[model samples]
Target: MLKERVINETVPIQKIYDEEIMKAHFSSETLPSVPLVYKIQPGSNQARKNLTPTLPSSSSFDIPDAYQSTNSDETFLIYDKLVSCKKRVLIFASPK
Candidate 1:
């Protein structure tokens, strides 16, 4: 049986001020200046000639027989049972 690991585990909650830190770092005085003028260059014919369009050799969607499960109802029933059991345990542990 798979144990309820979440009940046993302790998750460390972190207080992050990422947005505030980013805003301070990217303030006007520290920000990079953009160039007023720009230059453009034409693509070389040799670079274009070296490139080729590619298509998948075999475009197929196939599912193996082993992967297809016939016990979906049983799977869902087990999941439902586990969820209910966990809820009961939590309610029992909590003080009203």
Candidate 2:
């Protein structure tokens, strides 16, 4: 039998934060002034539901041109993608 994370009411208890990690991330000079941390989640449907699709400006929506790949010196590590909050990822705010 496969183990599964059951969320009856979706009470998130696990924390994904570390102090030393944050210190290193914030100190990086090459990083952007305002870091763009994309909220990646389990559901693939969320992006399709929340955001409308847009065609590339270089190409027409009806055109089927082979996408040209550009080489870059930039490198992104798993550590760079990570984020640490003061506490667990708990959104206490609610809408009326």
Candidate 3:
């Protein structure tokens, strides 16, 4: 006589549906509401003094001879040279 063979196998898996679960847990009607308000105080009449003291009203302000230069006219000349040079490239970078 021939004997029959039998096989049994099982595989288990768990999946989480985040959107459906969140939708069931949270709703607009269940959330709490709070009112927000802000108020500003009035300033006092006392005048604030500068941290760095200013020069006397009678004294005339003058730039130091060493720091002054005729570079203002040369700025356009340098710009023109940069424009003429095809190999040159200008790039400006700023955080803002």
lDDT for each candidate structure? 0.25, 0.28, 0.24
- Supply the global lDDT for candidate 2: 0.28
- Model 3: pairs clashing at backbone N, Cα or C within 3 Å: none
List, residue by residue over 1-96, the lDDT tens digit for candidate 3.
000000111111011122223445655665333111111101111111222245535323333322232323222212212344334333322223
Deviation from native of the Cα of residue 58 in model 3, angstroms = 57
Models ranked on lDDT: 2, 1, 3
- The backbone clash count of each candidate, in order, is 0, 0, 0
In candidate 3, what residue range of length 10 has the lowest lDDT sum? 1-10
Structure candidate 1, residue pairs in collision: none
lDDT comparison, 2 vs 3, better candidate = 2
User: TM-scores of all models?
Assistant: 0.15, 0.16, 0.12
Q: Which candidate would rank higher by TM-score, 1 or 3?
A: 1
**Tens digits of per-residue lDDT for model 2, 9-81:** 1222121212223545665665456323232223322433344345545322332111111123222111111
62-89 per-residue lDDT for model 1 (tens digits): 3332223232312211111224422321
**Candidate 2: regions farther than 4 A off:** 1-28, 33-35, 39-96
